[model samples]
Target: MLITRRFFPYFVTQCLGALNDNIYKNVLLLLVTYSQVNELPISVNMFVNLAAGVFILPFFLFSAHAGMVADNVDKAMLIRRLKLIEFIIMSCAAVAILSQSYLVMLLLLFLMGTQSAYFGPVKYSLLPQTLKENELVTGNAWVEMGTFISILVGTLSAGLIVASDNSLVAASATVVTLAAIGYLSSRAIPALPPQGKIEKIRFTPLSGTWRSIAKVRQTPSIWMAILAISWFWFLGATYLTQFPNFAKLHLHADATVVSLLLALFSIGIAVGSWICERVSYGHVELGVIPFGVLGLTVFGVDLIFAIPPAPVDLSTVYSFSTFIAASQHYRVMADLFMVGLSGGLFIVPLYAFIQSRAEKGECAQAIAANNIVNAFFMVTAAVLSIVLLGLLEWSIPQLFLLLAALNTVVALYVYSQVPEFAQRFVSYILSHVMYRVNVTGREHIPAQGAGVIVCNHVSYVDALIIMGSSTRPMRFVMDKSISEIPLLKYLFRHAGVIPICSPKQCEKTYEQAFEHIHQALNNEELVCIFPEGRLSADGDIAEFRPGIERILAADPVSVTPMALKGLWGSYFSHKGGHALTTRPKRFWSRVEVNIGETVNGVELGRHGLHQQVSELFERKS
Candidate 1:
C-alpha cells in the first residue's frame, strides 16, 4: 500500500533496470560458455570475466559525473534520460546477439554499465527527497528486495533462454522489453528539484573521484557506512560470481541447479529485507546490523563445513531436485540462504543511514563515492578469489572460511569505531525481543543540539528501552552499582553512560560524574540523569535528589522530562524483590515512555522538575 503512488513506479523502474542488467550480463556469460562463437582466440573463462569487468568499469570511470549530474539536475528527468539510453543499448545488444558478435556485445555491456553508473547516484539520492523521513528505511527495504528478486529472475531466465535456443535471442528480447518497461515506469516518476547547484561540470575521473571521496570522508559516520556497504558488495560479488562454477565444480550440478541456488539466495535476501522493515518499526535501526553480520559470519563459516567432497565423475550434472536429495547438500543451500538473508539486514540500514546523515545537498555525491568504493571492493573480491583459489590452491570452502573470519574482524573494527551500532543492537534486543516498548510524544526529543534528559527511574533496563525508542543517542547517568552488572558493564561503558555514587559512598566517583555530565553537555551531546539518584524501592517516584541541582548549576541546558510507565513491575525492577534476585513475572510486557515538553534550564528547579516528571507519569497512570 505504501508503494502505490510515487514509490511503486520507482520500484518497478529500478527492478526492471536491475533485471535487464543481470539478464544481459548472465546472457553474455552463458553465450561464452554454450554458444559456438570462436571469433577471438581467447579462453571462455577469460571472456566471461572480461564481460564482468567491462560492466563494472564504468562505475570507476563515470560515478563522479553521475553524482554531480544527479545533484545538479531534476532527478526524474535524469532517470527518464538514463532509461532511454538503456533502451538504445539494449537494442544494440539485440543486434549483437543476432550476429553473435562478442566484441560488439562487450562494448554494449560497457554502454549499459555507463547508463547504470549514472543512474546509481540518482537512484539512492532520490529517496530522501521524494519520501518522508519516516519512510526512508522501508523504501530502502523495498528497493533492495526488488533488486535481489530481479537478480534471481534474470539469472534464471538467462540460463533457461540461452540453453533453449543455443543463442541469446530470447535473452536479448527480455532485456529490450524490460528496458522499454523501465522507460515507461520512469515516465510516471514525479520530478524532484535538484538538491544543489553545480556551477560547472568537471569530468576529470581520478581527481573528481578523490574529491567526491574526500567530501564523504568529512562525515565519519557516513564514510564508515559506505565502507560497510562496500564490504557487503565485496562479499556479494564473491558469492554471486562463483555460483555457477561453484555449483558445477563443487556440487557437480547443472545450470538449472545453479539457478536454483541463486534463487534461494535471492529469496532469502528479499525475505530479510522485508522483515527488516517490520523489526525496525520504520526507523533506521543500526541494531539490526550486528544481528545481520553475526548471522552472516556464523552461517558463512557453516557453509564451509556443509560442503561435501566432490563426487566421482565430475562431468556428471545434477538437477535441482537431485542436488537437494542429499542432506548435506541441502544444508549448503540453507547456509547460502542465511548468508543472503544476513546480507540484506547488513546493507539496508547503512544505505538508509547514508541517505539520512550525509550533508544536505551532498547525498548524491556521497552515494557516488559509495558506488566507487563498492566497485573497487567487488573488483578486489574477484582478484582475491583468484589468488586464493588459483595461485594459493585453496579450495572454495577454504575461501568461505577466510571470508567468514575476515567478516568477524571487520565487524569488530566497525563496532569499535562506532559503538553506537552495538549499543543500539543491545537496546533493540531489550526493547523488541525481551519487552515491547511504546512511546508517546516522542517528538519532544530534540532532533539536534544538547539537552539534559530527566526521567523518573523505574527499572534497571529503563535506559536500554529508552535508548531503543529515541531517534538520537543519549548518554544516561546510572548508579555506580548498576554499572557493575557484568552483562551490561561493557555496553554502558561503550555508550558513555556516566556512573555516580553518594558522597558518603564514594566522593571521588560522585565528583567525576558531574565533570562527565558537564563535558557531555558542552560537546552538544544528550545527557540523561535520573535526578532521583537511585531506582525506587517501591513502584512510585522517589524524592528528587539535590544532585539534579548540581548538574543544572554546572550546565544550564534544556531539561526534557520523560516518564517510563509500565516498567515499575518489569523484570529489572524491584517489584517483587531486588532486581536479578527476583523471578520474572512476564516477558514482552508493554512499556510506555511518555515525553513531555522541554523546560527551560533556568526556569525548572529540582523540585519543579520532579513534580513535572511525576505529573507526566501520573497522567499516563
Candidate 2:
C-alpha cells in the first residue's frame, strides 16, 4: 500500500512537535534546578510537576472533542489549524524565554500540551482512511520510530542548550525555528475529509468519552490490548523520568552518560519498529509484544547489576566530556539498547491492533481513549516511581528489577486472558521457521472469508509453503499416504488439511474430500487443493484434474490459481527418487509463489477453469 501524501507532512509536524515539547520542558526543569539552586525545594519540584500535569490534563479533558473534530472536519484543514495554533504556542514560549519569565514558560508548556492533545486523535485516525489494512502496521511503525527519534534529538538539544551560558537565547531561537518549519510542512499535507458525518455535535464530553470507551470494551480482546499498550507507556514514562537520577545516584555517571542511555533506548525502539513491519509480513502480529516485554524485564533487571558503584567525589559537577570517560558507559549502553529494542517490539503491535480492531468511523475516538489511558498511566508511573525511590527506599537497580518482574507477570496474565495473541505467536514462528518463503500478489485473494485456491502439484512441502505465505489460514487437500508423514502429519492435522484418494482407488475417500471442501467454504474457510492431483512426474506442469471444478461448482466461490517456482529440485520433491532426504542441501533457495487474479465461476466452465490454471502456470514458467 502507498504512503499517502498526507503522511509525510504529518510525520514532520509530529517530529517537530515532539522536539519542541522536549526541548522546552527539559530546559525549564534544568533552569529551575541550576539557576535557583538555593530556592529549589520540594515545593518547587511539585510546582514543576504540576506544570507537566497541566499539559497532559488537556488530553483527558479535550481529547473527546478533539477526536470529534478530526472525525467531523476535513483532516488537512484541521491539521492546518492545529499547526497555526502550534505557531502561536511556540511564539509564546519564545517570548517567555527571551524575557526569562518562568511563569510564561510554564503557561506555554500547558498550551503546547493542549495542541498535542488535539493532534493526537487526528494523527492516528487518518492512517486507516488513507492506507490499506495490510499497510497499517508498517505505517504505524514508521510513525512511532520517527516520534521516538525526534524526542531523542529534542531532548539532546534541551540538555546542550540549557547547559550553555546563554541558554535562554539559544532555546528561544530553536523553538521559533522548529515551529516555523513545522507550519511549512503542514501546508504540504493533502486534504482528507471525514468518511461519514457524525450526528451528535452537541454531545456531552462525559457521554462521548464513555461511549468511545464502550466501543473498545465491546471487543474484550481489543480492550485487553489497549490496556497492554497503556501499561507499556507507563513503564516507558517511569524509566524516562528516573534515568537521570538512576545514572547519577546509582551508576555514578554524568549528564553525557544519561544522554547516551536515552539515545540508545530511542535507537533500539526505532530499529525494532522498522523491523516489525518487515518481520510480520505486514500484518499486526501480537506475538512480538511478549518478546518485547520479556526483553524489558530481563534487561531492565540486568541494568541494575550493571550499574557502577557511587563516585568517590559526590559533590563535584562533571561535564559531558568527563561523563564519557566513566567506566560504566559500555554497560549503560547495552542496557539502554535492550530497553529500547523491547520497547519497539511492545508498542508497534499495540498501535496496529488498535487501528485494525476499532470501529471504522470511531477510530479517532479510540485513539483518544488510548491517549487518555496513556496520560493516566503516565501519572500513575510518576507516582509509582517517586514512591519506589523515596518511601520504599529502593535503589535504582532494585526499582529496575521490580519493573522487570512486573512486566513478566503482566505479560503472562494478558496472554492467558487472550489465547488469540498466543495463537498469532505460534503462527508467526511457524512462518519464519522450517523454511523462508516469499509470496507475491497475495492481495488478489479476498481479504476475509472462504475461497478455493488451485495450484500446480510440485512437492510434499507445497502445502506447507502455501500455508507459510498466506496471510489468511488455509486448509489443504493432500494424498492420504503423504498426509500420514510423522512431523508433517502433526502440522497438517492442526492446520485442518484434508486427506484424499483418487476417485477410482477409493471413491468414499474422494467423496469425503469434496464434502469437506463444501463445508469449509460454507464456514468461510479458505481451501487450497492441487488440481494436478499428484507430484509432477517430469518436473513440468501436470494436467489439471476435474475435481477442483466440481468443488468450485458446489461451493460457488472464486478460484485463485497459483504457481510455486524453484521448488522442483528441493529434497521434498520426487526428483531424487527418495521420499525424504536426511540431509537436505536446500538453504536460502529463491522460491517465488505467484497468485493469479480470482476467476469468476459463473464465467468459466470446467474445461475453461483447467485452461485458466494452465495459462497461469505457463506465464509463471
The most accurate candidate by lDDT is 1
Residues 402-519, model 1: lDDT tens digits: 8899999998888888777888888888877778887777778876689989988888888888898776779999999998799889888888889999989999998999999989
Which residue pairs of candidate 1 clash? none
Distance from true position, residue 319, model 2, in Å? 5.0
Report the poorest 10 consecutive residues by lDDT, candidate 2. Answer: 427-436
Across 564-602, the per-residue lDDT of candidate 2 in tens digits comes to: 776777777877675486357676576777888898854
Off by over 4 Å in 1: 41-43, 164-172, 195-201, 308-316, 325-328, 478-487, 498-524, 543-560, 574-586, 597-612, 619-621
Question: Relative to the true structure, how large is the alpha-carbon lDDT of every model?
Answer: 0.86, 0.78
Q: Give the lDDT of residue 535 in candidate 2.
A: 86
